[model samples]
Target: MMQMPELLHSQKNSLFTAMNRFIGAVNNMDQTVMVPSLLRDVPLQKRDPDHGSYLRDAEADMYTYYTHLKSIRNEIEWGVLREDQRRKERAANTAVNAANLEAEGEDGNDLEQLLQYHLKGLHGVLAKLTSQANNLTNRYKQEIGIAGWGQ
Candidate 1:
């Protein structure tokens, strides 16, 4: 008899936004602090040892975010599947108590719309991350004087 609560949806949105922001912040860390050998074209072999550690640490952070994003995507997909199963199960019960099970004119298809909305948000974050990654890579190349070197 109770409809889905709006707070749950809002909380989900907030959590996703927070996650996106966290990833962005981590990605945008103080590269200057990370690479103290600033403006120097020190090759990988001659670079400071901390450079290796910095790369490793950055990789770990990105891996963690990747896992979390994958988990979220799977969670949303499974959640949508669960709702479909629930709707199918309820179809049988609606025969006996149609009034209680069904609203006046609502067909309860909002879940699909919600799924789409979440998917769009997910893809949007993915695009942002991808663009940021490309920018980071390009910046690294530029720092090492390879991206536009001798051009």
Candidate 2:
């Protein structure tokens, strides 16, 4: 089993720390999955029944998810979204802006409340990403018939 590097005490609660941990997990997954083709056609949720609800609507193969994970890592590392993501973001923003225009009045605490909400959601997302990366690495080891891998 691989262990992630320890974060500094000051960085423990920051968004960067969470993202860094997620990146490390994905890097481990990328290194472990040397033969990406081995992941082709494999379902993401078959290994754990509890994880099915995490991506209930996704039927994409493991290779698709592997590439997606790499793309997410790249996005986080480069601090830039892919064109498709940017497009989606633009659409979502337009809708959000329209909604905001419709509801004009807001207290000063709204910004803090919104920030807290997003921060909590970001932490949840980062944790899920880390778990997915670790799971993929383990699954890759299993696919290669590694015996007693986690023992």
Candidate 3:
């Protein structure tokens, strides 16, 4: 029911807010986890069935997640992807576009619908990223026996 301008403005605001929160969370995690070595061999708690299970290597999972969060933070700050990631993303996008073209027949609302779908997905991902960064920070503290300092 929103006018075009209102919808655009709202979407932009939500996206920016999510991005900023994620960046801040990652920055806090980076500052907190000074010794990545300590993250080695640490295992994250098992998630609820609905939330999905972690099949990653428990010994390296925390370190990997830590590095990934920082990488995402850097990408967001720089507004660019690493070459390998960009290449993979381009290939995925091409496949998705081809599928969409074949499935969606020239609906006037297609582009708008696609944009909204992606925006919603992006928002969910950002929120999850922020939570992960915070969790990593908290877990690192616990690993080093500094539990309950900044939960």
Alpha-carbon lDDT, every model: 0.50, 0.82, 0.84
What's the lDDT for residue 135 in model 2?
80
All candidates' TM-scores?
0.32, 0.68, 0.68
Over 53-91, each residue of candidate 2 has an lDDT whose tens digit, in order, gives: 545326887898899999999978885977899899999
Worst 10 residues of 2 by lDDT: 48-57
Which lDDT tens digits does candidate 3 get at residues 1-151?
6579978788666988899999999999999998997776676564566768644454556877788899999989996867899899999999998888778765659878988999889999999999989988987888888979864
lDDT-best of 1 and 3: 3
After superposition, the stretches of candidate 3 with alpha carbons farther than 4 Å from their true spots are: 1-13, 50-60, 82-108
lDDT digits (tens) for residues 51-108 of candidate 1: 5542323233432433344454455435535777888878877775576536554455
How close to the true structure is residue 109 of candidate 3, measured as C-alpha lDDT? 91
**Best-to-worst TM-score order:** 3, 2, 1
Q: Give the C-alpha miss distance for residue 29 in model 2, angstroms.
A: 0.5
Q: Which candidate is the best by lDDT?
A: 3
